[model samples]
Target: MPDTPAAPRFRSGAGRICLDFMRTLRLRGMDGATEELDTPEALAAWVAQLGPYPGGTKIPAPAEGVLGEARAVREAVYALLTAARSPAGPAGCPPKERGLLNRAAAAAPPVPVLDAAGSVTWTAGDPVGAVLADIARDALSLATSPALDRVRACSGPHCAAWFLDTSRPGNRRWCSMETCGNQAKKHAWRTRHATATAI
Candidate 1:
């Protein structure tokens, strides 16, 4: 048998977190996995399965306070994605909506938990800070980078994910064709066939 591959590790930072969450959403929804996570460890374990980061090491665990902050940011990202998917306002009015989305997407780093001595319980070992740095870079890139013409939420109902529309057509739909697009097509086909057979 082939050697069982180790899970992927994450580089300390927000991009890693974003990517991790995106994968989690995809796997839990599209892949037909029944594993239910009720705690942060579940999220961590899911990320661990992604294969090792460039270097095989665990991201330093966040201080208790940092965990809450990171969670908040993660939730905000999801909210922004959800809003973008709906045709409510953002799509109709680009400038104002983009500004609002940018503001929300700005995920601030959680302050480290400290002891009585004012020593931070979490340090460089904690990858949450690194994730924050990545978020900062990504936000700046989305704002100032001319290459980014359109940043929008994906069109898959099961996928509330965001991506820069780098395609020449600027009409990119799903976060990943293999994940959301393929799943949607398969479901539609199944429904059609099921109906035809019933008829």
Candidate 2:
């Protein structure tokens, strides 16, 4: 019998970007590839890299003289996620601030890559910013009353990563299972074993 091909995993665009941003923030620099504070092209490339595409995906030519705009887009999403966490005081943003957020929300979706013969080829349909918009909307939707807060950063002391908690309790913490939760369990087990040995 001939082998069947594996099914393509469908991932929502915003979900991928949200995970990328979380991964970037958690590691800061050394752990993963992210935007550098200096250089426009590098920053733009970093933003582009956030897309979940295979290496064969062809990137569209960068827009002319709009590196600043790309940077603004990245920062805008960052601000929205940050603001969503703090509802009171200076947490709520003004109209001018929201203008950028809306721009990012409405930005064009990522283009598909073409083959050498100019035919349509493999592609990543979702853009990073688009995913952030969806994540923010869904994150906020969980709130049933004014008392229910929207959005939250991971409470793990070493990791301040953000995540949308759709749990019934609305008390989720760790950003990912492979990272914080596993680490916490390992730490607990070691502590328990150590105490038993000491006694």
Candidate 3:
């Protein structure tokens, strides 16, 4: 039998659920924009990859309506963070987007259950929606918290993602050192070599 193909790998470790979800719409407001959650199956895949489910847990695909709502919530999250990070701050957000974000934040996130071994596992009646709810709530808290100042857009030339700069010096520039930072170092080396050769 033919082997089942693997699901596409999604990016993670943006320091916040909302920031990670925001990347589903890659290159937001920029050229070559791509939608990662284009279908219900894709939405389920995201939840399976990012949600707090145990290993090998199968995340059932949500309804088409749920996919739409997920996208809406993602946009609302982006809008809210944008406003909050701007000079005017969260107060600059108009009421409509704020309401959407607030409603999403109000959703029931995954609940924790402790087994006899004292192991904790997260459960949710609607896993996809629950993850999205956690994202919304995270965004709401992050936007209002003093940690908002720590948020920074990645300096990678090809990257448009944002991340919380937890570095003590507050000088982080890339989303992932393994990816963007390494690429930058190579580029800088090539440029220096070229300049030396020309001289």
All models: lDDT? 0.48, 0.48, 0.89
What TM value does model 2 have? Answer: 0.55
TM-score of each: 0.52, 0.55, 0.94
- Which portions of model 1 show Cα errors greater than 4 Å? 6-53, 75-126, 144-148, 191-199
- Segments of candidate 3 deviating more than 4 angstroms: 1-8
- Candidate number of the best TM-score: 3
Q: List, residue by residue over 1-199, the lDDT tens digit for candidate 3.
A: 9999775479998888889999898877788889999999999989998889886689999999999999998888888889999997988776888898888878899999999999999999999989988988998999999989999988888888998888999989999998889999999999999999999
What does candidate 2's lDDT look like per residue over 2-60, in tens digits?
99964322212223344334343333434553444245444334444544345444445
Off by over 4 Å in 2: 1-19, 27-55, 60-68, 89-91, 94-96, 110-150
On the 0 to 100 scale, the lDDT of residue 166 in model 1 is: 60
Give the higher-TM-score candidate: 2 or 3.
Answer: 3
Alpha-carbon deviation at 94 in model 1, angstroms? 17
Q: Rank the candidates by lDDT, best first.
A: 3, 1, 2
- The better-scoring model by lDDT among 1 and 3 is 3
Candidate 3 TM-score, C-alpha based: 0.94
Please state the error at residue 29 of candidate 3 in Å. 2.3
